[model samples]
Target: MTSIEPEQSSELVLRLKSGDVLAYEIIYNVFVKELLATAYKKTGDRVLAEELVQNIFISIWEKRESLVIINLRAYLFGSLKLSVINHIRSLVIENKYKEYKQVSFQEDYQDTSNLVDLQDLSGLIEEGLNSLPTKTQEVFRLSRYGNQSTKDISSKLKISEKAVEYHITRSLKRLKQYLKKFYIFLYL
Candidate 1:
């Protein structure tokens, strides 16, 4: 087990390095089951352990030409240790992502849709009002929200009724253009 009988293993390594399929098969047959068991014990996951063992064999075959192994059994087990560590790290990252998604879903569901929309629309209206000239904004608020007639607005402000109508029209046109980006503006 230490060196596959310690005498023939050097010959086996040389042949395996020279791309001898039979030597590779002999090494795999000797070590695969033990490696699989070690991987399974470390990972506690049968499928992942089997896959890790398979990858270890594949790595040995791929690196045969460059390898300088004093003990093949130790090398395979060392590879298994690294694979198990990587698997555990991936599980931790996956758990963190699941937790993040769950928190995001709860936050999304807790938000009141109507309240959000109303707040957004009010903000847009306030921004549009700020963009208007002071007199036009005053005329628009009185005519629309204050329920004042155009003649009353003009009389109170000491302007002609025609001038009040012009201010209201200008303010409405400017606000319409400013709010055009919002979907609710189409209905208004």
Candidate 2:
């Protein structure tokens, strides 16, 4: 493990907290390789690992003013660990949802009554989706229905990954609010 002396790490942290772009660049250059290696070891996917490291640096930059770091390397590694875990959790949930959708679709196909209810629910959800901005709706559909990764969506949409995330997050919040009344039991 690479360890920085306390004094140097403290100085770097102070620079980062002050929103120094040069300090941010220096810190990124210093830690990016190690962070990428760590993420790759955890994920075993080069592209995903790269994206994870990039997102971590972007997060650090965006949240610079609120960042409090006693040890910059430790903080960066901790953030990487959390990001990997969250990514894994999201994959698991997405897989489960995909399975549920497949099974439900099969069941609905065999039963006219269930198919009617599903059609109705699908219509309501479509209406809610349509209420979002065009970009947000497109992003949400690409993620949820097309089963595209954020990186893929960003590339296809010619938007940043952060923008993709932002759109999906906003779309979900709006959809939840709009559908909560009718789907209260389903949500609970």
Per-model TM values vs. the true structure:
0.57, 0.57
* lDDT (Cα, tens digit) per residue for candidate 2, span 1-188: 24467787788778888888887887888889999998999999999999999999999999988988887888999999999999999999999999999999887777976676578677778988999999999999999999999999999999999999999999989887767765774555
Lowest-sum lDDT 10-residue window in model 2? 179-188
Best by lDDT: 2
Write down the worst ten-residue block by lDDT for model 1.
Answer: 178-187
Tally clashing residue pairs in candidate 1: 0
lDDT, candidates in the order shown: 0.85, 0.89
Query: Which lDDT tens digits does candidate 1 get at residues 1-188?
Result: 33387667778888989999999999988888888888888888889889998998898899999998777667778988998889899999999999999998877865665567668777877799889899998999999989999999999999999999999999888877767767655356
Assess candidate 1 and give its TM-score to the true structure.
0.57
Off by over 4 Å in 2: 1-3, 113-188
